[model samples]
Structure formats: C-alpha cells, structure tokens
Target: MAERRHTDIAVIGAGPAGMAAALTLSEAGLRPVVFDMNATPGGQIYRQLAAPQVDATLMGQEYIAGRSLVDAFVTADIDYRPLSRVWWLDRDGEGYVLGVLQQGHSQQWHADRLILASGAMERGWPFPGWQLPGVMYAGAAQILLKQAALLPSAAPILAGSGPLLYLLAWQYLQAGRPPALVLDMAPASRYRTLMRHPVRAWHGRSYLLKGMRLIADLRRAGVAIRQGVSGLRASGSDALERIHYRHAGTWRSLPGTLLLTHFGVVPEPQLMRSLQLRQHWQHEQQCFVPDRDATLSAGTNLWIAGDGGGIGGARNAEREGHLAGFAAIASLGRQPTKRRSATTRRLLAARRRDLAARPLLDALFRVPEGWLAEQPPETLVCRCEAVTRGELDEAIAQGGSGPNQLKAFTRCGMGPCQGRQCGESVTRLLASRTRRSPDDIGYYHIRPPVHSITLGELAADDFDNTNN
Candidate 1:
C-alpha cells in the first residue's frame, strides 16, 4: 500500500504561481508542501534558470528576473518535492488525497486545503503530415533550447499565430539562429479588430512595445514574415522536408529542415476535469476554463491559481497565487493584517493590469472560423490513436452526443496522452459539424490516473521510498 501522509495545505506545480503562493504562505508562518514535476523550481517560463544550461545573458531580462523567485523558493521553509508527478487526486471526506509518484515509487499525500497551480499547454494544432519527424511545437523547441542549449541545425520554417511564435523566433534570432520564414495565420482583419480596444492598448503598453521591438529586430535582421496565411501542411517521406501554405490568394511551398508551429495555449484541464468543477467556455480565449470566484476558489477546500484557472501570463499568475494564498490563510482562520490587506489590494490591481490587454491579444490571435472543420479528411486529429478528422466526422454522423461518446466509438482519447493532444480538436470538430457551441458539445469525461504509470509502480509500497 502507498504510504499515506497528511499536510495542512498543499500547492501543486512550482511555476510562478506556485512559487508565489508558497512564499506568501511561508511568510505567514504556515508550512505548505510544494510538488513539481520538474527537477527545478522554475516552471516553463523561467525554466532552467536555477542551474543555467546556457549563458544567462542569452535568455533575456524576463527570464533572468525569475532567478530571484526561484532563489526565494529554495530558501523558504517549505517541503519542496522535485521530480514528482501527481497522477491521481481523490476527495477523502473533508480533505483530498493525491496519488503521487516520485523517484520510481508511489506515495499518498492528504491535504485539507489545496491550491492547484498547474499551468497551460500549447493548443493542439493538427495538420496533414504534422506527425512526421522534425515537425514540432514552437514551445517544445524553446524548452529544448532552455534545457539543453539545442537548436535546429538548419533554419526552420515557423508557422501559425500567437505571441509564442514571434517570441520563439526572436529568441532564436538572439541565439544566432533565425528562422528561414514566418507564416502568421492571423490576417489583417484581426489587427483591425484589435484596434477597437485602445483602452487596452494603454494598459498593456509595455507588452505591445516589447512585441513591436521583437518584430522590428527580426525584420532588421532580415527574417522573412508573411501574414494572412492559412492552409498549412507538412510533407516528406519520413521527416519534415517542406511546408505548404497559402498567402496572397496563392499557394506556396518551401523546403525546410524543421517546422515549428504554435496556435496559443489553453489551461491544462485533466486534473480540473477529474475534480468536476464548474466550467464555462471563454469565447475570446476559445477554451473551456474552470469557474472561480474573486478569491480563486473553485469549490470547497480548493483554489485554482495561474494559467490553469485561465490563460493569464506569468505576471497575472503570480498575482493570483498571492490572492489564493491569502484566501487559504483566511479559510484557516488567520485574520489578515493591515499589511496583508494592502498587499491583497495591490495584487488585485496588478492582476487587472496584467489582464487588461488580454482581450486585444485574444482577438488578434483567435482561431479562424471553420478552421477545424476545414481540415482534410485524411488529416490526423488524434495522434495518439491515429484517428483522423474523417473518423471524427463519421462518429458525429453516427449520432454521438459528445466527445465521451465519440471516444467510445473510436479510442481517440484512450491512449497514453489521455486526450491532451486531441481533446480541443475533437470538441471543436463536433461543434463545427453539429452546429452547436463547444459548451453544448462538452469535453471528454476525464478520470483518475491523469498521468500514465505502470501497474508495478502503482502496486509498490512507499516503505522503501525515500521521497515519502
């Protein structure tokens, strides 16, 4: 049997949100345990900053700033667990139980109150030949660069829309490896729509200025950028050799060694779904986000912070973390001091500023209408099970009500990824075909064991597990 341990409070994920939350709680004289899958404290945004894989100067100032947060977290009196995965979460009476695997052994952690800081994942962007080798997400490439100092041997063709695409391109440019071409899927009309929000412009002036600078730098360095792009696909026998896209009402093909694509990101929802919290479709973000109150409370004895609550960036996530920490402290009957109350107000204001330009950003990078439905029949939707768009359509035609039924009709989400790779595509495809909103169509019915694990591992006792 797994060794069962108990804590007064627990924080999941060691990202910006998690670190801030733990720091706040620790300062209040509470010892909240933190669990992170990464070997280090900094999440993806500040990844590898604690132990630099590349020169710190190459990562830019935004990354360099996170070192302070990681340093503070490392020194804080907290039970920090690295290289740990919480695969299953269960409600146990008044508290909760987390099935965690660490260092090849399983242990159970019981907590009275929990703060879920699980971050976001890149949106699923499926296209013809996307499964080929050398075709990967732009975020994955950035991770490799941060973790291993790896870069494409050849100039890559970066496609799709969102801040990450340009951010990665600029990072590569800074690293002395600019992409061969950039195919921006967002058209001119999106920019025109973005102009409707001038108030947002003032609030998000810093981000806008930074983005403009990145674009200007890339162009000055002679990197090619084309907007109004669509109909992207990759082609090669065994690896990605060429990319095909449409622009200026004409189709063009280009040879490339690497193809990196991004379509923005959505909250990582596997754990939230297991909890069965109320969720609503955010039409702007184009993802179903869990419903939370002003204090970030999702339900009783629980709070959600960071991108997992929605797609707010790191700053917003950090603010939410502090708010959740305060709320959790209040729930534990700790009356807020005047300083804490003032800090809460400041955090709320900062969070509003952090999210002020979100609507404009969302409008500019929104997924195109009928985008999912426009995929060719042969295009794969579920890479895990080799399911195709044609198959999803066939399932819809067969009278399935939603994704759960479609999963039974075809094992699209039953693979090791557990629908993380294809859940959004399936929901959007269903809505597009049936003329229903995604909320009406609903998402897959997620269960426990959110992450894949071996039977032997699950059965092993925590007796010999030093992590316990």
Candidate 2:
C-alpha cells in the first residue's frame, strides 16, 4: 500500500483541460495535483512530440500550440503524476478516494475537490470486416504519425464520416505517401442542408474553412474521392488486401493494404459514470455526456472539463478547463481577481461560438441509420468475447433488454477494454431490438478497477491495515 497522500484539489487527465485547470488553480493560491495516464502532459489534440524531438516541421506547425501549455504545467508549483492509471473512485465523507495503479503498484489518494478531464476517444461503429487486422481507427493512425513519424507501409485506404479522416490523409500526402482511395460515408444531402443554414453555421466558420481547405488540398493532389459510399468491407484471409465499397448505388472494389476509418469522437465516460455522476444520452454526439454547468461543475465538489463532457474540439476544451478551475475557486467563496475572471469570460464566449456548429455536424454524420437498423446474425458484435449478432439475437429473444442484462446473458461487454470498445455498439443493437431509444436501453453498469490490475497489486502492503 502506498501512503495516503492528500491534496485540496486533484485533476484527472493531463490534457489541455487538466493542465489549464492546474494553471488556473495555481494562480488562485492553490496547489492542485494533476495525474495522467501517459508519460507526458500533452493530450491527444496537442500530443507532445516524442522526447528530445523539438522539430515543428515533422509534427506540423499547429502542434506548437501545446508547447506553452506543457511548459506552464512543468513550471507550476503543483504535484504531477504521470503513468498513473486511476482504477476506482469512491466517496469518503466530504472528500473522494481514488484507487490508482502506478508503476505496477496499487495506491490510493484522497482529495477534497475532484476535476475530471478524462478526454475523448474516437467513435466506434461496427462495419463489416472492421475486426480485420489491417483495419484501424483513423485516430489511432494519427497517433502513429504524431508519435513515431510513421506512415503506412502499404497504400492507405480511408473511409467514414467526419473531418479527421480527410485531415489524416492530407497529412499523409504531405509526407509524400498518398492513400489509394477515400470513401466518404457522408451523403450529398448533408452538405446541401448545411449550406442552407449559413446563419447558424457562421459561428463555426473556422472549422468549416479548415475542413474545406483539407478536402481541397486532397482533391488537388489527385486523391480519389468517392462520396456517398456504403457497403464498406475488407476482404482477405491473413490481412486486408481489398476494400469493397458501394458508391452511387454501384458496388466496387479497390485494391488497398490498409483501411483507416473514423466518424468523429465521444468522451471516455468510464470514470464519470463510475463516480455515479448524473449523465444523459446525447443524440447529437451519439454518446452519454455528464450533466455540467457552463462553469463545468457537475456536483458540489466535482467538476468536469474538456471533451469528456462533450466534443467541442481543443480550443473549447481549454476554455472550459479555465472556467471549471475558476469555478472551483468561486465554490469556496473565493472569487478570482477581476482580470482572471474577465479573461475566462472572453474564453467562455469563444467556446460558445465554437459549439454553435455542433448540431450541423451531428446531423451530417448521424450514426448511419443502417447500423442500428439491421444486424446480420453472423457478424461479430462483441469482439472480445466473440459474441455474434446471432447470439445477441438469442439473448434478446430470451428478454435481455438491457446492456447489463445482455452482459449477464451472453458476456457481451465483459472484456479487457471494459466495454469502451463495444459499449456504444451493444447499446445501439439492443435499443433497436427492444424498439426503444438508446437512453431507454441504458449502458452497462461500470465498476472499477476501470483498467486491469494485477491481483498482487491490489493486495499490496500499502493497503490500510484496518480493513485487512
């Protein structure tokens, strides 16, 4: 058992939100301890380039924005813990106790105030042959490019909705390795409707302009662009050798070696849901989001910031973190100086402007109606347990109406990923079966250890002797 360290504030996740929160709390005469799962501070949006690598040309000029945040975090007088995998959280009197696994040791810490900046993960919706070895999420592909300066060893094939897809391909083209094809899931109707709503879309003009710029660049480079693609599948015995897709009602097959896909993102809500915080299903984002104020507080002593609450991109997350940090001070009846408050208010206004275009994106990339509309009984639904759609059908036929109940019946979500990879897919599948909305279907009951921990680590010598 590690010693029970104590602090006034504990911020989880070292991304833009948590670091920004720590910086704000430090300026308010408080020392906040920040913890991150990764070894370094930068989160996904501004992920730090590999150690000793300061070259901006490789990771791109935009990555330079994260340097100041990481630097400010290092200079702050706050305790920072990296490679700390927080597993469990529990209410203890007026505070909270966090169960953490660090460096192969299990430990616990107590905090009077908790800030959750857990960040986001790429949205996963099962498509045919998605489980193939050579297929991966577009976000994962971007990580490889950012962290290792790596590119596909073979021709890259990208498909699905959202801007990230095109952006990653553009980055690949910049690296002088162009993809074999681009299969867009977005139908023409979505863009036509978006153009008609310029009044509401104007607020998110920056995002719109950036997306257009990426698409324009890819087209100029002679990248094959196929819009309104469906029936996407990978075919090969040992690895992906061909991509089968349908465009304009014509079935076609393209030779490819890698298949990258994405459809935007959603928060990793395991920690928030494990805390039993209030959350609701967001139809727009097609995921659950913690209920939070503009200040980002969800409970009296609990605050949520960043994409973990909702997807508003990196800039909005930083602004939200500042608000949540200052709000923590105000909760204790300690208003920050007017200058600080004024700056955060300005950021808050910008955050709102950034959020204005979300509804438009939501409609355009709405989870493909066909995914939940029908399921081929032979297709795998739970990749971890090898549970198939046929098995799920039997479970539902036997009245497994909820995700939790399905887990008990077929072990659909009891996997190493703790349902992160399959929760949305499972929920949508059952929701369709029961003729109810996903909210009515509910999510799996999340318990912790959130991530796996060794048996010996849980029984380490540092545990409280009184309990033993």
Identify the leading candidate in terms of lDDT: 1
Regions of candidate 2 where Cα sits further than 4 Å from its true position: 50-61, 461-468
Clash count in backbone of candidate 2? 3
Model 1: lDDT of residue 334: 80
Residue-level lDDT of model 2, residues 1-468, one tens digit each, is 767878899999988899899999998889998878998887886765335233565445567767777788888898888888899988887788998877667778999999999999987677667788899998998877767677898779999998788888888888888888888987568778678888767766766787788889889999988888866777778888888888888888977779999977999979987888887888888788889976788887889999999988777788888888888888778757879879877987888777888877777766674574464676777788888878888999998889998899998889888888788888888777778887788888899889899898887755334347
| Cα RMSD for candidates in order | 1.3, 2.8
Once superposed on the true structure, which residue ranges of model 1 sit more than 4 Å away at CA?
463-468
Q: How accurate is candidate 1 locally (lDDT)?
A: 0.89
When summed lDDT is taken over every stretch of 10 residues in candidate 2, the lowest stretch is 49-58
TM-score of each: 0.98, 0.95
Candidate 2, residue 34: Cα displacement in angstroms equals 1.1
Per-residue lDDT of 17 in model 1? 96
lDDT of 1 at 225: 97
lDDT of 1 by residue, 293-389 (tens): 9899998889999999999998788888889999999999888999999999999988887887898888878877578789889899889999998
